[model samples]
Target: MIHAALAASALSLSFAAAAHADPIKIGFIGELSGPAAAVGQDMLDGFNLLLEEQGGKLGGHAIELIREDSQLKPDVARQAARSLVEKEKVPIITGVSFSNVMMAIHKYVTDHEVFLVGSNAGPSQIAGKQCSPYQFITSWQGDQAAEAVGKYAQEKGYKKVVVLAPNYQAGKDIVNGFKRYYKEPLADELYTSLKQMDFSSELSKVTAVEPDAVFAFFPGGMGIAFAKQYAQAGLSGKQPLLTTFVVDALSLPAIGDSAMGIISGGFWAPDFDNPQSRKFVKDFEAKYKRVPSNYAAQSYDAALLLDSAIAKVDGKVGDKPAFMAALKAADFKSVRGDFKFGNNHFPIQGMHIMEVVKDGQGRLNLKTIATPFKSYQDAYHGQCPLP
Candidate 1:
């Protein structure tokens, strides 16, 4: 019996030390195809940039990333996740882009006792009653940005406005978030197809209403299509289109001159005044030849967070308790500047009101004008099981 116990202890020690010998593998699943390809590619680039900077290492262990494309489909995301867990055997998975995809794979990842360092797509359900100890969000809740925009609109005395978003989990979250803070009945609350590119009919409805402003949440290609259509409809700046998560760095080039002077809300921009943020922006632009979007910033922070947590764990990826504690500590310097984890594993960060503007060289970009929410905790955190 004593010899058997000694053998068992020896095997456990060998398992813990194996990460030092073999590269610690992590999984990345995102919408790498379809309309949201930009979203996934930006996320991949952000994480890869960090890896290259760190010599392809995190903590004391060499890192190996296994990637899969979700194709912006729920079933595809689920299958990709299963393959990562069952085949790739990655203990940690990150780079989930859209809320619907996150929801599709959340249970599977968490049930397997694997960690999910979600870079985007924090739905209210996960933020609240369904919050998992194995889950951590580097991004804000889906509604947080939209809620800030709603507050801005309310304070600007826009009593009647039209609200529009894609018909999906994230869209519903954004609309609900906007309504939460606006505290007024909207002139029109509308939803478009999740895959719809044409906004002519929606713009027609908004023009007919002639509300004080039009508030919408259209991200990636959808935003580009909507912005072009709205501008072509002669309702962009004239009708006062207010938005969150739109007119960002990724979409600016595609949206062109139409993106200028659009009122939007965001978590970070390249023009921020922090050293870490400045360095990240400079390096990212130097490598990618484009300004990093909110998705890129958040995904970069996830990489930084993993570095800190993995280093703290000392290459023992099997040490789940220590690793979870390290992640919760959030010891890394984020590109977003100051950062920390909320009890529900969502970020407690600031949200700013911004406008799309041109630089001295006439390059379209975002400028932070007002920060209405600082160190903001999401509305659903109180409902989470965590303290």
Candidate 2:
């Protein structure tokens, strides 16, 4: 029995050594199944595109992508993160879908001393007191988009607005963000289940309140589901719906005609009218045969961020401090036009309030309405420890 145990331990050690000897592993953990799978798939596609462009390499090491399907569950995300950091020993982890799942996996990454590159899922805690030097967000925080929406709504003289969200940390952040800028009276504040797809009851509640506009922050599949239900319940035409991160490409196509005339706040869109953005839009459309969502753009930016870090470190990924410094410097061509890192390692980039407009051919496109804010910073940045 002692000999058998010795043999097993030896095999395990050998496997570990072989893994280390192999290519550099980067983890992509998100919802690869369920209704939100398209978002994860787009993120993976964009990340893979970067890898392919770089010939599947970074820092003189062959790139090996480790994908984990969180199924959009926090516990599942935590398990995947543990496997990546503890078992696989990946240097960097990226592409978490839900905010709760990101929160769940954050402790593990910080504790294990692994760098986390966030593609989506930007929780306020990561930007605030719980912020870590090891964590860098490739996208804006949860409230930035909603803040833009709020600013736009205020400018448009929207009063007595109704807010709908999925009763979570992200939801609260978005609502608070809107309220921070929107001094108007709130007609209703409705919270539904995190997993709730049916918003009929909530819509009914909104109808009763009769707000001038409705703002929401439903991400991923929930966004698609909620938008569809919102349209079916005739709220789309009845009331002016303003949203952020909810009516993105992932749900826009699903919402079809219902998505048309919908106004939302965004940091990046396919028709952003920048050279880098044009290239990304064309290439992603050719490769994926569909419009790339904001998640995809953020994922592509994450890859570029890693590439920049690797270049700055001169093929020495072993130096975590140097890599982190490069990331903090924000020395990459962001597909989102302009890019800079905030004090909290979150994006300090331009935010636009966009409306979904259909072209002559009836193809859905985002049209910029107003540049309510530019190069915005998250409210929690002052509270972060990082420079």
Candidate 3:
């Protein structure tokens, strides 16, 4: 009986040691090429900052990141997701750059019983009726920043404005969010092609109407072209420009002289004025030799979130229920202040009116001007089933 007991104790200790020492596989599907590569690369850098600090381990388990580029193509992203799920058998996935890519693999990721800690791309469809328990967004919903912009416009009493987007799901969501709070009707609502680089025709349309403000949402390289063209067309000084996810660190260096004093709404800013945020900014800049954008900030939070949850479960990530519960608990301090999950698993966080300006060192950067929404939940959370 004593020998049998000794053998059983040895087996239990071996199992515990194996669990602690095992390497965890995480799928990183991102837009590593194309116009959005800056976004993806920054997210990876930010996530790596924490992981590297922990000696490439989270919750006492070595992390093995399996990276696959979506190349900003839906089909490519879908196939990558399939491979990660079926072949790699990763229990967790993160680093989706664009909303379109998120849409491509949302069903597959959740249906396969995988946890998706979305670093970006929070479209309305997944946040509402089709919300999944397996999906947790570390970033704000797609429309939250636009909603903040809308609220700012409403507060300023902008009676007439024009709206422009890329005519995609995310663009539509941003437009809808803008219209929701801006009580007044728009002067002109125009959507250009996603690949439409020359905004001359769109600019002509805007110039014809001549509104008090213009709200535009053209991300990645499209945004860079649009901003330059808008400036070149002599509309930058004439009309007040409001934007979402555009006038940030990623685009500012390219935007040059025209980026100054441009206004937008976002959740994170470099000078966010918090210990957590300051530390992240300092360390990230030290490592990357560049300014970190909101995308990077969101991805860093995802890593902190995973670390906290994984530690709680004693590295037994294979146990879905415990891992899910640990995620729901959100036992981590976010780089962004006041973060929590709604019933829909999207972040219930604050939004602020952000502005690009030259700091004391003559560097243009996004700075938080006003906090409009305090712990604002997305409009579609009511449609989720997790009441």
Candidate 4:
């Protein structure tokens, strides 16, 4: 009887060890290559920073992060998503950097019931009537940042503004959102090819229109190219450039003095006066040797959100319904401070106006000017049917 009891106890210990060794696999798909690679790399750095801080574990469970480069192509993104979903079987996927890429794979990810925690590119469709219960965005919608700058320009009495964006879904959404709030005449609404690098011709149009202000939504390397070209054309000092996500921390370093005096709008800035924000900025700079952009902040928040939700579920990510419920709660201390999930699963947060200014060290950085919309909610919230 004693020998039998000892054998049973040993078997129980073996099962306990196996349970402890189970790994939580997380899939991260983003444009790790191509023009937008910097954006994706910043996001991955932020996400990895959080995991590193926690000793590479989440909710007291070992985590295996599977990263795939989408190469900024819809087909590539779709293929990467399939590999992560079908073969790797990650319960959660994150680090989507572009709206077009997200739109391509969102349906497949959600249909399979895998939670997609977005770090960037909150498109209107995903934030509104088409919102999936399995998808959550820590980033602002494509329009929200532009809307903030639009209101700022309107208040400044800019009568005619020239708007330029890549001819894409996000570009159109940004333009529409800006128009919705700007209520001013558009001098020109120009859409350029996504891969078009040389904006000398586009800048010529802006000079011809001679609008009161120039607003754009170029991000990543496109932003660098535009800012440099705009400055070289002597328009940086001549025309007031107001933009969204264009002259941010990520792009400012590359654009340098070209981004100076440019006004942009976003939810978080490196100079934000919150303890969490300060800590994140300081730590991120120490780790990455560069200031963190709004993209990095949002991605870091996504990781924290995952950590919180997984904890609530006690690491039982297999319990899909309960895990999603925990995620919907959004019980994380966001670096942005006043973060909450709208009914549509997008962030309902404030939008602040920022100006690119040279710091005491002569390095260009974003300085918060004003909060145009405090506790702003996206326009598509009411359209979302998710309860």
Best by lDDT: 1
lDDT of each: 0.91, 0.85, 0.90, 0.90
Candidate 1: misplaced stretches above 4 Å?
A: 1-20
| Candidate 4 lDDT over residue span 1-387, tens digit each | 999999999999998997777689999988888899989999999999889998898777778999999998999999999999999999999999989999999999999999999999889998888899999999998889888988999899999899999998899989988998899779999999887789999999999988888999898888889889999998978899988888877888788777878999889998888888888988899998988988899999999999999899988999998998999899988999978898888988999999988877788998989998989899888888987
lDDT: the better of candidates 1 and 4: 1
Q: Write the per-residue lDDT of candidate 1 for residues 311-342, one digit (tens) a residue.
A: 99987878999999999999999877789999
What does candidate 3 score on TM?
A: 0.95
| Ordered list by TM-score, greatest first | 4, 3, 1, 2
The TM-score, computed over Cα atoms with residue i paired to residue i, of candidate 2 is 0.92
Q: Tell me the TM-score of each prediction against the true structure.
A: 0.95, 0.92, 0.95, 0.96
Model 2 spans with C-alpha error above 4 angstroms: 1-21
Cα RMSD for candidate 3? 2.2
- Candidate 2 lDDT by residue in tens digits, 1-387: 999999999999998886567677899898899877887888898888778877897645578899999998888888899899889989899998778888899988977878899998888998999999888888889888888889888988987799988888888988998898898988888898887888888888888887788998787778888888888877887788898877776677777888888889878877788787888888888887888888899999998888888888875666988888888987878898889888888999888888999855577878887887888899999989877
Give all candidate RMSDs, comma-separated: 4.2, 7.0, 2.2, 1.6
Which segments of candidate 3 are over 4 A away from where they belong?
1-20
Which is the leading candidate under TM-score? 4
Candidate achieving higher TM-score, 1 or 2: 1
